[model samples]
Target: MEAPPVIAVVGPTGSGKSDLAVSLALELDGEVINADSMQFYRGMDIGTAKITEAERRGVPHHLLDILDVTEEASVSDFQQQARALIADIHGRGKRAILAGGSGLYVRAALDVLEFPGTDPQIRRRLEAELEAAGPAPLRQRLEAVDPVSAGRLGDARRIIRALEVFELTGRTFSSFMPAREYYQPAVQIGLDVDRELLRERLARRVHAMVDRGLLEEARRLDAAGLRKGRTAPRALGYAQFLKVLDGTASVAEAAEETVVATRQFARRQLTWFRADPRVSWLDWQDPGLVARATGLCRTVPVQPLA
Candidate 1:
C-alpha cells in the first residue's frame, strides 16, 4: 500500500493556518507537528502567539516547548526530529499535519533539503566576527561569496551559519537548497488573503498579543536568558519587546515595531510559499474553508488545489 499523504497547511502569519491545520487533522484523523521555530522554545507562549491548550481541542501537538529559551533551534535538527516524529505518526496509521507559517522550518520538515555539516572552529570564528563586526560586514562577506544565500539569510545567526557553511564546505550555502521536491508524498494547502487586510490583521494581532501579557512574558524570558538565544532573540515579538525590557523603547513603541516587523515577515512567508506552484491556494476567509480544505485532502489523483 502507498504511504499516507503528508498534509501541510502553510501561509503567512495571522492567515489562520493553525486553525485550518486543526480542522484538517480532525477531518483526516491526523496529528499536528509544529513547524514554528519560536513555538519550539518554552516560556515563549504569549509573545509567540502559541496556541493554548483549549485551542488545541484535544489534538496531540509535537515539537512544541521542546527547547528552553537559551537553546538555539536548528532547522537541521528539526528536520531530523520532525521526520522521525512523522514516521512514528505514520507507523501508528495516522496522518501527519505540518502546521506553521515559518517558511524555512516548514520546508525543513517537509522538503528534500540537506544540511551542510558545521565545523566548530569555523562557526566560532564566524560568530566571533558577527559579534565584533556585527551583521553588516558578515552579510557583506556572504554577499561576495554567495549572494543567493546572503539574500535569504536575514538574521545574524543565519548569516553566520551560512558563512560557516561556506568556509567549512567550500561551497555556497545555496547549493544545498532542495530542488522543489517533497521529502514525502504530501499535499500543501496555502491560504490567500488581501495584502491590506493581512496588514490590518497583523497589526491587530500584535496589539492583542500585548494585551495578553507579551511584555510580561518577555520580561520573564529576559531573566531566563532570552538574549542568549541566537534564534529566539530574532523572533518578531520577542526582539521588539526585548528592546522594551532594555529601556531602549516603550511598550507601545515595541508593540508597534512588532506589528510592522510581523507584517513584513508575513509578506516574506507568502512569497516563499507562493513560489512553489504545487501549493493549492484557498481564500482564508471563505465561509466553507474547512469543508473546502477537507475536500481537497480527500480528493483522489490529487487534483490541483485552488
Candidate 2:
C-alpha cells in the first residue's frame, strides 16, 4: 500500500502563501489545513488574513475559524487537530495541504514535538512576571536560563513559554523539546519573495484590510473582551488597533503601526523558515512556481512509517 502524502506551503505574511496554497489545492485536488495561530479564531478574519468562503476558490479549508477569539489554543491542540484532519483527508484519498506563516504552529504539526503538560502555578508566575516586568526582562531571563531554546524562539510569547517550561520542570526547555523528525510524509514548499516587494505587499494588504471594515471587526472583537493578552489578540493588526480603540493612537497611526509590525513579523517568519532544512524554497515571482512546486510534490517518495 502507498503511504499518504501531505504538502505544506509556508512563508512570511504577505509572501503570497494563501494564494499559492489555494492555487495548489485547486491544481492538486487538495484541502488547505491552516497552520496560522491567529487564523484559528472565528472572529479574527480580517486581521489574520483568513480565507473567506469566497476566497477559497471552491477549495476546502480546515482548522480555520474553529475557535472563539477568547479561547486559548495551544500548539499541542493545533497539532492534535491537524494530525486528525490530515488522516481524514488521506483516508478520503484526497491531498492535505498545510499552509500558514506561524512558524511554531507549523513546526509542531510537522515535527514530532512533545510539549510539556501545562502547570497552572508556573503559568501564573510567568504571567505575573510578564505583566509586571514586560516581555524584554522575561525574554532576557529566558535567554540567561536557556540560551538554546531562547535562540530558537525569538518571539516574546514563545520565549515566555520556554521560561515557563523551565520554571515548571527545573530543566532547560531545550532538553524537553523534541527534534525535527518528520511526523508524516510531506512535501515542504517555502515561498520566498524580495524583501522590499514583500514589505510593499504587506502595506497594501493592511490598507485593504482597513478599507474592508477592519476597524469594525476589531471593535467587535474588543467588545467581546477578546483583545486581552491572549495569543490570538497579539496578532499583527489586533494589538495595534487596540491602541486606536483605547485612544492611545489615531486610526491612521494604528494602521501605519500595523504595517510596520507586520513587516517585522514577515522578516521574522522568513528567518524562521530559512533556518529550516526540510523546506524546499521557491521564488514566489517565478513564472513556473506552481509547476515546480507540483513537480516536487509528485516526486517526493512517501515514507511508510511516517
Candidate 3:
C-alpha cells in the first residue's frame, strides 16, 4: 500500500501559514490539522488568530478549539490526536494538511518523538524547588545536568520539564528524540515573508485581536486561574495581558510587550524550521503561492506504506 501524502504548511506567526493551508486544502481536497500550541483552546479565537468559519471555506479543520483554557496540552497529546486525524482523513481519500506556527508541536507530530510519562515525585520536587528558589535555580540545575537540552530549550517551563524528566527517569530527554527518518511520507512547506511586513502585520493583528475582545478572553482565562507563570497561561497574549490586569503594566505597555514577544517568537520559529533540511521554503506573499504549492503537492513522490 502507498502511504498517504501529508503536506505541512509551517512558518513563523504572521507569515500567512493558515491562508496557504486553506488555499492548498481547497485546491487539493485536503483537511487541515492544526499544529499550533494555543489554537487548541476552545475560547482563544482572537489571540490565536484562529481561522474563522468563513475563512475555512468549508474545508474540514481538526484539532482547533479542542481543549479548555484551564487544561494543558502537550506535544505528545497533539502527536497522537493529529496522527489519528490524518489517518482518518487519508482513509476518506483526502490529503492531510498540517498547518501552524508551533515548531515543537509540528516536530513532535512529524518526527513521532517518544515522550516519557510524567513522574509525580520528580514533579513535586521540582515544584518545591520552584516555590523556594524560583526558575533560575532549577534552570541552573538543568544546565549542569544536561547542557545540550538546556541550550536548546530557552523557555524556563520547558527546561524545567526536561529537568523533571531527567531527574525522574535518569535519562536525558534528548535521548528520546525520535530519528528524523521516522516521519511518514511528508512534504514540509515553510512560509517566508519580509520581516518588516510581518512585524507590521503582527502589530495590526494584535490590535485587531484587542478589538475582537482579546481583553475579555484574557479576563475569562484569569477567572479560570490561568495567571502568569502557569504553563497554560504563559501563551503570548494571555501572559502580557495578565501583567496589565495585575497593574504591573499599562494596557499600552502590555500591547507593546506582546508585540515584541510575538516578534521574537516568530524569529525563534524561523530558526527552528530553518534548521530542518526537509522543509521546502516558499515566499508566502508571492502572488502564485497557491499555484506553486499545488504544483509541489502534485509532484511529491509517493512512498510505500510501513
lDDT of 1 by residue, 1-306 (tens): 245767889999999988888888888889999999999999999878888898888888999899998998888999999999888887777778999988888888878888888788998888788778788999899999999988877878788888888888899999998587887778899999989999998899899999999999988989999888777888899999988888999999998889989988898898899998989999999999999998887663432211
Per-residue lDDT over 35-153 for candidate 3, one digit per residue giving the tens place of the 0 to 100 score: 99888887777778899999999999999988777777878888899888877787777889999988878877778578888877877778888888888887788888888788878
Identify the runs in model 1 with alpha carbons over 4 angstroms from their true place: 133-140, 151-155, 300-306
Candidate 3 local distance difference test against the native: 0.83
Q: Give the TM-score of candidate 2.
A: 0.91
Q: State which candidate has the highest lDDT.
A: 1
lDDT of 2: 0.85
The C-alpha TM-scores of every prediction are: 0.93, 0.91, 0.93
Task: Name the candidate that leads on TM-score.
Answer: 3
lDDT of 3 at 46: 76
lDDT of 1: 0.87
lDDT for each candidate structure: 0.87, 0.85, 0.83
Between candidates 2 and 3, name the one with more favorable TM-score.
3
Scanning candidate 3 in windows of ten residues, the lowest lDDT window is: 223-232
Better of 1 and 3 by TM-score: 3
